[model samples]
Target: MSGPGTAGAVETEPASARAGLGGRYARLWTASTLSAVGDGMSLTAAPLLAYTLTDDPRLVAGVTTALTLPYVLFGLPAGVLVDRVDLLRAMRGIDLFRGLLLLTLAVAVALDRGNLLVLYICFFLIGTCETFFRNASQVIVPSVVPRKLLVDANGRLLAAQTAGNEFVGPLLGSVLFAIAAAVPFGIDAASFLLSALLLSSLLGVRSAKPSTRRTGGPSTSERPADLPAAPGSGVDSAGPVSATRPGLLADMTTGARWLLRDRLLRGLALAAGGINLVLTAGLAVMVVHAHTVLGLGSIGYGLLLACQAVGAVFAARLAPRLVRRLGDEQALVCVAATMAAANVAVWLVPVGTGVGLALAAAACAGVTWDVVVVALRQTRIPRPLQGRVNSVYRLVAWGAMPVGAALGGLLSTAFGTPSVFAAGAVLMTMIAACLAEGARRRWISDPR
Candidate 1:
C-alpha cells in the first residue's frame, strides 16, 4: 500500500467542487459539525437534569466529575485500543454506543426512572466511549486529508464543535430541556446515531500502513522477516491487521510510556492539563455565580453560556489564520497568554451581569487556545502514536478536572465566587508564563 505520492494524498473529491476546500472532506466536516452540536446539547442537558432532580450543588459537581473522570482513568487505555482497532470501525462503534446510551437515558427520563445512580452510570459509559472515539478521529484525520491541509482540517473541526456543540447545541438543549428534559436527550441520541452512520460509510476508505518500528526499536522492514510476531497477535500475517480484542489496561500503559518518553509531548500535555483543570474549576463556579450571584434562572444561565459559546466560535474561526501567520509554537504561546489575560480580566470585573461579559472574553481566549493547541498536537505527534499520546495526555491533563470542580465548589461555599475566579486566574497566568517561555526557547516546534 506504500507508494510514491501516496503518503500525503487526500481522499476527498476535487477542490473546485468543494468551493476551494478539499473534496469529500467537506462531507466529513459537516458530519463532525452536526455531531458536535448534538454533543453540546447533551453537555448542557445532562447537568441541568442532574441539578433539577437533586437540587444539590455537590451532586451537580459530582455529575460533572463523573463525565470528565474517564479522561483520567481510561484515556490512555482507550488510545492504545484505537491504535489496535480499525479507526473507522472504532469511531462508528463508539458513536453508535453513545447514541444507544443516550436513548436509554431518554427512556429512563420518560419512564420517571432517572435516578442519580442511573445518571452516574450512564455518564461513565458515555465518557469512556468518548475517549475511544476522540482518539480514533484524531489518528484517522492525517490518513483522510493531505498533510498540508491538517491545520485547516483541525480548525474546521474545532469551529464546528465550538459553534454547533458548545454554542448552539447547549442553547438548544437548554431550551428543549425547558420544554421537556427527555427532548434534549432524544436529540442527542439521534445525533450520535447519525454520526455513526456517516462514520460507518467511511470504513475501509483509507487504511494506514503499519509502522515497521516499535517504540525505541528499529523499523519493521529492517527486522528479520522470520522473527516471530508478538505474543498477543495484534498484527496478522495477511497484512496490517486491526486490534479486535479487548485489552484496555495494557493499551493505556502503552500510551503512558509514549508520553513519558517524548519531551515535546510531555510539555504540551502538562500545559493542556493545567489549563483544563483551571477551566473546569472556573466553569463549576460559574454555574453558581449565574444562579445565585447574578440571580439568573436556568434560562438566563443558558443564555450566558450561549454567549460564551459565541466567543469560542469567533476564536475558533480566527485560530487557523493566526497559526499560519505566527507558526504553531508562537501561536500557542500567544493564545495561552491571551487566555491568561482574559482570566485576569474576568477577575477584575464587578460582580453580576458584568461578569457575563468577562466570561465571554475568557471564552474567546479559551477557544483560541484550544483550537491552536489541538492542531499543533495533531500535526506534531506521529500518526501511529496519536491515539496513545492523546489518551495519556488526556489522562494527566484532565485528571485534575474533577478535583478542580470539587475545589471550586468548596471555595465558592467558603470564600465565595470572587475567590474562585481569582484563584483560577492566578493558576492560568502561571501556566501561560511557563508555556510562553518554553516555546520561546524553541522547546516546541511546529511539526510542519
Candidate 2:
C-alpha cells in the first residue's frame, strides 16, 4: 500500500539503500546523539559555572557572546578547512579537542579555582572547534546515506538532537550540578570521548562527490590521457578531481554567488535569518521572565526550557509528513506563521506558573519551523558546497543572534519582559509574511 511518493517507492542503488533501524546509519546516528548530549551538557554547564563563579548576569551573558564570536570571525575559514580535510577525521579531532577542554574545565571546577578569564577562553576555543565540527557533519551526511534518504537522515539527526541534547542534556546537567558542578563536565567529557571513538571507526567510507568537477581539470577517466592537463595544472594523478585552491574571500564569494543567484535559496536564507533573530531574542529574555516575572526559580526555569525541548522533539517527528502533505514551501510558510502566532500568545498571556504551557506552545512552533527550514536547505543546496553554503547561511542567520540577545536585554530593561516577546512576535510575523509571499511566487516550490 505504498503511496506515489512513499519511502518504499523511491529508487536507490543497492549499496546506497536505506539503512533502517540497527543499521550503519543507526550507528552514525548514535554517535551523533552522544555528541549532542555532550553538547547539551556543556551548554548548560558552562553558563551555570560562570554564574556560580561571578554571580554576575553580565558575565553569564559574556560567555554566550564570546563563544558565538568565533562563528562570525572564523566561519568561512572553517568551511574551507572542512572541505579540504577528511570529514570523519575532522569530526573525531573536534570531539577529542572538546573532550580535553571540558576535562580542563572540570578540573578547574573541582579545584574551586575556576576563573572567569579561563572560562571565557575555554568557551571561545570550544566554540571554534564546534564551528568546524558542525560544518564537517553537514558535509558528512550525504556521504553516509543515499540521496533518496537524505531527508529521513536529517530528520533522525534533528530528532536525536532534540531528544538527547535539548531534553535530556539540560535535565542531566541540572541534576549533576545539584550533586556537584564538576560532575556534568566530567560526563560531557566522557560523551565526547565516546563520540570520537565511534567517528574513528567510520574511517574508509567514502561519501558521494559533487556532480561538477573542480575548475582545474577533469579526472583521467573523464578526459583522455593523451590530452594535456589544463594550464597551471596540479592533479593528484590517481585521486579524484578537485577545484583550484581558491582564496578564503573567493571561496566565500563563490558561496554567496550561488545563494544570491538562486531566488528560492536566497529567500529561504533571508526568512530563516529573520526568524532566528526573533527566536533568539525570545530565548534571551525567557530565563529572566521565568525568574522575576513569573516568580519561578532557576530550577523551574530550567524545567520549562526542558519542556520546550520535549515539544521540539515531537515537532521534528511530525514535520516531514506535514511538509509532504502541504507541499514544502506552503508548509514552511505555515510553520513560520504558527511561530508568530505562538509568540503573540505568549506576549499577551498572563505571567503565572502556567508559563510552561506557553513555552511549550512556542517551542512546538519554533521546532516545526526549524525542522522544515533545515530540510529545505539540505535538499536545495549543492552537496559539495554544503559546507560553504551552510557557513554563509549561518553567517547571515546566526549573525542576528547576538543582536537579538543584546536587544532583548535592553528591551526587557527598558519596557519590561513582555516587550521582548512582543518584539519577537512582530519579527516572526514579518518572517511568515515573507515566506508566504515567496511561496505565492513559487520561489521555494521545487527541490532545486
Candidate 3:
C-alpha cells in the first residue's frame, strides 16, 4: 500500500511502502558508515600519537581541543556554506580533501617527520571540513526520506555510526597502530577515498528553500507544534522573507536569531552544550586513564571503546521504539538521568565490573539522546533553514567540546583521571534535574 508520504518513484515502491527508508537514504547511510570508519581510525590513532609526543595530560588534551575548536569557531558560517552550494558536490570535495590530508599525515608519520604542530594543524583543518560536512549531510536527509520515517532513518544512521566509528574502526585502528603508527592513518585515508566514491553516485541533491506558507499537514507550520511549558518562554512568529540572497553575516544572523527566539530549540541546544562539555571532559583524558588507572595498552583502550559502542549500537536499534514508548520529552529526562548515574558509577566502580557496565549504560543514554533530539530537530526545523539553524544549534551544542577537553586535562592533572568522571556526573545530574522538571510541566510535545 503506497501512501502519499512514500518517497521515490511510484514504480520502485516496495510492496509495503513503509518498509523502505528510500534508496537515496540508503546510499547516504552507506557513505556515512564508510566515513565513520575513517573517522574512528584517525581519532584513535591521533591521540595515541599525541600521547607519545607528550606526557603532559594538558598537552595530550590539546589535541582534542584543536580538533573541536573548529566547531565553535566556524560552525555558524559552515551552515551558510551548506545552504549556498550543491550538497553532494560539496561533500565529495570535502571527503577528497580530507583523504589527501590524512595521506599526507600518514607519509609524514612514516618518515618520522611528524610533529605536534603538524598534527594540530591537520586536525583543525579536518574539523573545519567536518563542520561543513555534518551540516550538509543533516540537511540532505529530509529531502531524501519522507518526514514520517525520520526517527527510523536517524536510528539506523546512528547505529551504523556507532558500529563503524566506535566498534570496527577503533578495534582495527588499535591493531594497525600496534603494528605501525602510520598504518591506521593510511587506512583512514583509504576509507575517506572510498566514501567519496560512494557519495559520487548520489545524484540531484540540494537544500530546499524555506516556505512561509504551510504545506502538507498541520505539523509543517512556521512554529514548532510543541513549545516548552516554561513561563516566559516566547515564540517568535516568522518574519518577512527576503527575495534576494542575504549577505553572509546576515544569513548567519538570521539562523542564529531563529534558534534563539525558539524556546524549545534554544533550551535543547543549550542543554546539549552542557552535556557535551561534560562528556568530552571525561573523554579527553581517557587514554591517560586507561594507561595509568586501568593499566591498558592501545589494544585494551580500543576494546573499551568497542564495548561502549556495542551498547550504543544496541540502544540505537531500540531508540525509535523507546522514544515512541516514552515520548520525546520524557526520553530526554531519562537519558540525562541515566547518563548522570552511569558517570557516577564509572567514577566509583572498577574497570572489570562497574566501569564497563557504566560506560555501556552511558553509551546507551547518549544514543537515546541522539535519536530523540536529532529527529526532533529534523521534524521541527523547516528544510530550507536546516543548515543554518542546525549550525547555530551546534555552535552551542558542540562548541563546548574544546573547553571541556581543556577542563578534562586540568582535572586529570590536578586530581587524577577519576575526577573527570566525577565532574561529569555532577554536571549531568544537574541537567537531569532541569529536564525532569520540564517534562513534568509538559514542556515539549513529541512531533512524532
Instruction: Give lDDT tens digits, candidate 1, residues 244-283.
Output: 3335566556657877887877877788777777777777
The lDDT of model 3 is 0.74
Superposition error at 297 for model 3 (Å): 0.8
- The per-prediction CA RMSD against the true structure, in angstroms, equals 7.5, 7.3, 8.2
Q: State the lDDT at 141 in candidate 1.
A: 65
- Candidate 2 global lDDT: 0.66
> Evaluated with TM-score, which candidate comes out highest?
3
lDDT tens per residue, model 3, 66-102: 9899989998877776544556777888889999999
lDDT of 2 by residue, 50-134 (tens): 6566533445556666676677778777766654455677777888888888888889889997788988898878778877777
Candidate 3: where are CA atoms >4 Å away?
Answer: 1-30, 141-158, 201-243, 324-326, 379-384, 445-448
Candidate 2: worst 10 consecutive residues by lDDT?
Answer: 1-10
- On TM-score, the stronger of 2 and 3 is 3
Worst 10 residues of 3 by lDDT: 1-10
Root-mean-square deviation of Cα positions for candidate 3 versus the true structure, in angstroms: 8.2
lDDT winner between candidates 2 and 3: 3
